[model samples]
Target: MAYVLVLNSGSSSVKFQLVDPAGEATDAPLVSGLVEQVGEPMGAVSVTVGGQEHREELEIPTHSFGLERAFAIMGEHNVGPTDVEVIAVGHRVVHGGKLFSEPQLIVDEIESMIEDLIPLAPLHNPANLDGIRVARAMLPDIPHVAVFDTAFFNHIPPAAALYAINSEVASQYDVRRYGFHGTSHEFVSQQVPKLLDKDPATVNQITLHLGNGASAAAIRHGRPIDTSMGLTPLAGLAMGTRCGDIDPGIIFHLVRQAGMSIDEIDNLLNKQSGVKGIAGVNDFRLLRQRIEEQDQDAWLAYNIYIHQLRRFIGSYMIALGRVDAITFTAGVGENDTEVRQDALYNLDMYGIHFDKEANLVRSKEPRMISTADSPVKVFVVPTNEELAIAQKSAAVAAQARAEGLY
Candidate 1:
């Protein structure tokens, strides 16, 4: 089997997945693992291969150290580096900053571009670059490709994307919407056409990826026409701990009137706000439990979240003009039954007919949740971002090989 390893490195964790070019056959796990708490207490690496689980607890001081251990353990378990030939290494690069529109094989110039994007994605791009540098150091002979998160929305038209302000100011600061979660959005958007056995040009969708960092996208004919998140992941929907869609004046007010430092405000918005600010908790599961017990704050938080989500759905519908399908993906989008029901409950006027039973069918595979009679289809699609990265990496590698770019 042709194998490729895809790595997504974050501030505190590294998620690695090995994909089979032929796809997971005969129940193979598609080899995956996580290296968590890379530089802090509770640091450890866990791997599950072919239905077996192995975990090791050790302090890792850096991305290089953790990755070295990970490769070692993969070999020890017979899913070793040498047992399978690796075609390419796909790195999930968080910010491309208009330089990279598609997955590109990593090179000196590409590394420089990633560094230049650090100021825009301080929390993510640096760690991603760390992984890339370490990968280059360790596997100098192998082909490495950078799969970007901002690449999908690079073609968003001006009307839907451009702010209604001065063009000169927008250009000076590079202030415009560059949506994140492009990998997930692209994966699901393409999946819709493939699932319906129709050409991508014929499909229109509004996809919601409701994970810790949530965002929504409006795709028309397989292109990103509009998306919820803006220049950063902190712009659109209220996420686990992110203060989304906040007033710009609030920052100035806090700094001048409340006497808070910029760093403090940043921390407050990125880390201390969102559901945690109003509800004192971020996990939707925990919040749901409190609501079941009739906790007032929990009810308030749930209400606020549902209201915001409903508003986003309506807004995106207007953007799309006519919606063929709406998809739910990622953590909350996949498993949160209550949220699905709440968001679609009263949208009948929009020609959305939901199958309550189908919506409740919780499974790993993609399945339609809307009723047969519904004009607009709704679905639950489990996202496999690693696979998406791997596919893009393989395609780019093939293209480069054909063109002798490497």
Candidate 2:
């Protein structure tokens, strides 16, 4: 089978999956693994193949060492890149800026362009670049493709994309709402039309990608009308540890009154806020347990999370005018029935009728959870970003081959 190696590299960890090119979106990867704690004193690596798992704890000093050991483990299972027909390596690049609206075959110039975008994604792009460089060196013979997370919503209308700040200043710094989690939103939104059996260009969707890191997108037809995320992932919904939407004046207040540095404030809002900031726990399961135990803080966190979610949902409903479907994907949206129920609670006036029993049913496959006769449908579609990236990478690689670019 022809497989695409999909890699999502963060600052300290790498998530890798070997995806069959012809696999369904919901299909499990042929092999999956994680190389964690890179450059740390004690690191761990694990690979799962054919429902079997093996893990090792050692110093994963660099991206190269970590990945090499991961592939080595897969080799022991006789499913390594060398043993299989690996066609391309797909990379999850966080910020493509405005330059990339689609996946591109990785070339030196492409890598350089990605590097140039590092300033826009200081925390994510560097690690992504490191992984790309290391993977390219390790698998020099195969095609490498950069699948951007922001590419899907790159064309959001000017009103939605621009910040109301000085246009000159915004232009100078490239400040605009370049939505994150585009891969998930795009993948899920496409499935909405298919499920409704409506034409892709005629469907309107509000996709809520609720996970540790959550974001919402309002897609009119196939194009994004607006999205919750802005220039950075920190601007969207209150996530596991993100502050989400907040007044800009608060930054000035913190600097002037609290004497906090920019980096400290950045860490605070991005790592110390959100559900974690209020409930002292970011995991939805833990927060739910606390709520069951009558913890007031947990209740507040849940309320804030749901409140912000409902606000966005309502706004998108208005933006679309005639809504077709409301989709909930990612972790929290898929598994947490309470969140799903509460997010759409009392929206019957908006032509949405949530099915209580249907919402309770849990499965990995994409399924609808709204009344059959409701004008607006609600669904819990699983977002398969790895599969999307792998498929895009395969297509881009094939295109490159046809054009003799490789």
Candidate 3:
């Protein structure tokens, strides 16, 4: 069977999945695995195949080594390099800048373009590139495709994408809103129309992807019109360890008064802030426990999170003009019922009537959480970014084959 391997490579970890994109027999992956703590003394690789999980501890000093070990593990499951045919490898590239608006077949020139976009995604693009290079070297004959996180927001009009700064400076620097989580947003937005049994062209929805890293997007007529995250993922909702939206003056004050270096300030805002900054923890479950114990700090963090989420929802509601549905996806969005309720509370004026009972039901499948009489439907959709990447990659590879390029 032909498969598409999807890789989401991070600084110290890599998550991968093998999917038969056209498989209709089941909705499960052929194989999935993760390599964690690369470059560390103790590293681990775990794989799930045929409904069973297997793990190993090894020295994975780099992404290349980790990926090689992953391939070896897959071999044990009879999906080795010589056994199964891999048609394409799909990479989750964090930034595409203005160069790419859709999945593109990776070539040497395209690789160089991704390298040039390093400044726009300092922490993510390099790792993504590394994975691409390694995978290409390992599977030299197979086609590779890059599915960008910023591609879904490429169509957002200038009125929403451009910053109200000096036009000359902004243009020179290529500064504008380039939303992240495009795969999740696009996947969830398409699912909304199917859930409502409506034409995608007639659907206007807001999708909230709230995981450790969170963002919101306003999709009008099946296209993204605006999103909460800006040029970087750090600009949107308060994340696990990010400060989210903050005044520009705070950086200057910290530099002049607090005598903090630029790197130090960046570390503080990106690593030490958010719920972790306020409550001394980043995990939602731990924060909820602290809240149950009447910890004021955790409560405050929870309040701030819900407040920001509600603000974005309200703004997107205005942007859409007439909202049909609002979807919640990703980890926090799909599982956190309290957050869902609090975010949609007191929105009766917007025709959003929350059904508390329906919200509390825990399920992985997509379902409506709004009351029957509510004009605006609320849904919880579990995002499958890997599947989306595989589907796109398969399509690109097939198109290339039709042109005799692959």
**Highest-scoring model, TM-score:** 2
Q: Candidate 2 — worst ten consecutive residues by lDDT sum?
A: 397-406
Best by lDDT: 2
Model 3 accuracy (lDDT, Cα): 0.92
Candidate 3 per-residue C-alpha lDDT over 11-81 given as tens digits, one digit per residue, 9 for 90 to 100: 89999999888863237898999999999998999989988988999888988888888889889879865
TM-score winner, 1 or 3? 3
Worst 10 residues of 1 by lDDT: 21-30
C-alpha lDDT score of every prediction, in listed order: 0.85, 0.95, 0.92
Query: Which candidate would rank higher by TM-score, 2 or 3?
Result: 2
Taking every candidate in turn, the Cα RMSD to the unseen true structure, in Å, is 1.8, 0.7, 1.4
* TM-score order of candidates, top first: 2, 3, 1
Candidate 3 TM-score over all chains jointly:
0.98
TM-score, prediction 2 = 0.99
In candidate 1, the residue pairs with backbone N, CA or C atoms under 3 Å apart (3 or more residues apart, or in different chains) clash, namely 75-80
Q: What stretches of model 2 exceed 4 Å from their correct place?
A: none
The true-versus-predicted C-alpha distance at residue 22 of model 2, in Å, is 1.5
TM-score per prediction, in order, is 0.96, 0.99, 0.98
